[model samples]
Target: MRGSNSSLSSLSRRQPWKLINIADLPDAVLIEVVCRLSCSKLIFRCKCVCKRWLTLISDPYFVDHYLRHQSDKKRHIIRTLIYAREYVVRLRFHPWTNPTVVATYNDLMLCYGNLNRYCICNPCTMQWVALPRIPTYTVHRRSEVRVGFICDTPCYNYKEDEHEDQKGDVMQHNAAYRCKVVRIRPPEKGYYHFSFEWKVDIFSSETGEWRKAVVLSPRAITLNGLGFPHQGILYWLGREENGCSIIFGLDPFSDKPKCFFIALDEPLNDLRHFGVCGGCIRMCGLDMATRSLIVFYLKTEEDGKLCLSKRMVYSLDQNMYLDNESNVSLRPFDPNDEDVCYIYVYGECVRYKYNFRTRKWSTIVEEIPHQISYSFVHVQPWWPTPVPRLPQRACPAESN
Candidate 1:
């Protein structure tokens, strides 16, 4: 018996070393290898793998890493809508061969269309979640609804990861972290005596139910705008008591909403859009008489007063226009560091970069066939990383 055992051990030791294929590696080892790959390539290839690998790669941590790497490697592309006299069209930057309608926030892209009607897709993992229909309201015989996501208050415990060995508590805390959807709509035209009364309905993702309708304040109602949730608050561009446009920040954690006025001393003409830009809320207005684009930079003082510090004007001729009493022509790619201003010129759906140092602008990518859209969210590519995906495929079945 001892001689047989010795012979067996000798045979095992003599066996040639075996090579392990990447696909055969354990979950933890595979994840580490995946971290080294290009985000787009890794995502595209991983789909053909087994289900367990799919689930592991789809975790939020991997998604976050992939996004961070993508942003670090390239300028984030922004989606925009360009309105022509006859048609409203969609455009994207860094055109993809198979571009699908996607909902976009800061850096994250959700599938576009009705929240209840679309599929939520995570491009990085090619994973999707189907969601039920989102509620809506009608205005002027047409249902006008805007849907957005808001992070749940009392943020999930971040420290649990430090003590992963304590599994029970960590799992409990993670399960409690949740998010909700906020829907905004104006009341039907004839239903309310006041035309400005708007109803805000919130749907909790955790509970999957709509909350009671909450009437907005007079100022918030009149604006009839959607809020951009950032840093635990929902911010909207609103008109103040004096009728000047300003940014209002709403912290759902508190009972009363906090307001910040973007005090542009100059008169605003035909204000069209408001959004968060470069960590501050920004409003864009068009000077109709001159066909010039005006962007205002807002600041908050120690005394809590809001002030508009910088005014930039871009004329149709593609030149930068400084704020002067005299009519100014716009300049292309002119950047003002003091005002934290960066100007991106659009030509044939391609965005060119203009460095303040060179005082010159050049095309980043030439001859790209995709139409590109420019919006405030495009300015900061890192902001939309967590945007949720739609629930269903937006295109028709036959088309897919």
Candidate 2:
């Protein structure tokens, strides 16, 4: 024992090699390692370590590569929604690099930090491109306004697995074309709070001018500022003052808009939401009485343009709901989240998830409810890559 201890002391005193730092790694090697990371929350926090690491992370090529992986992975960490209070916040952090997302279509978002300004950006890649302010306004009860933007992708087949016996089939949405932005404005003097008279102006990249719709739609109020693209067409579900539900559809090829209001088969009582899931229109109804969500897929037929077929009825877990005092509509939104979907952030934050294969439901994220459209900190939507394009950002943000 004495001899072994003496030998160990002599060897310890002999020598020790210098420690290696993560910063010493090559750019390619570091990038490969960092791209696998789930979200930028950690990256932004750790970027303060060294200038070389910062510079490498800022490279557009590396950023693009990472975002490509992010889109494929479908792991969204930042939950970007809207603020009901509409508080105008200043640049608290790096607004350009870590921008605030206002509205989202697919993975692309209408982002702006300060009010009255807007831009389109992919948060996953940290690639931001500025968009011109849409010069239009609508006068609703509070002069409320809504904006519309659409992203085009090449030949995205949304209904790849439709039943074979279906009589009619919706054509594949040709997304390869350039995207267009639309601004809708209701006349200030003539329109009532429930007026259907509205005008739409579209901005296309091919033609740099804003073009007006061929026909003004009576159901334009259904647009509601945001448009959902399904099978290459944009749709907005609306309900008028008299309580009649309407559907507004815009065909990209013809630039023609149409409105239809056929009676719904079922008498809907609770608040409902419409969204595009798997390239088809899906409606989710929040039933506060039983604390259950009724989901239906909208099908088109020769007789009736809008048809609702029951998809699934998901019950909100008592543990997730936690509050029995209020039967107020939770307003379930953003069905894109896979493990769970975000319901309204009212007095309490409520969220749930459904499995398509198993048709199972689970409570994933729940927190104290905040303002409207505001996403929580850890549970954020992974912004997807709309298409493959190099971003031209307003602030050549430090990804030098």
Candidate 2: TM-score? 0.57
TM-score of each: 0.53, 0.57
lDDT of 1 by residue, 1-400 (tens): 9999998899889995688787688866776677666434445577568787778766766654554445456743443331121111222231222333323333233333333443333333334443444444322222245445555533223334455564332311122434554555544553222333445555444554455354444342234344566556555554544545555444443333234334344445545344444655455665645756677755545655446666666554344333342332222221123232233333323344443233454545433223232222322232223323322342323111
Error of 2 at 188 (Å): 6.4
Q: Candidate 2 — what's its lDDT?
A: 0.52
TM for candidate 1 is 0.53
Name the 10 consecutive residues with the lowest summed lDDT in model 2: 375-384
- What's each prediction's clash count? 20, 16
lDDT of each: 0.44, 0.52
lDDT, residue 277, candidate 1: 49
lDDT leader: 2
Q: What value does the lDDT take at residue 55 in candidate 2? A: 85
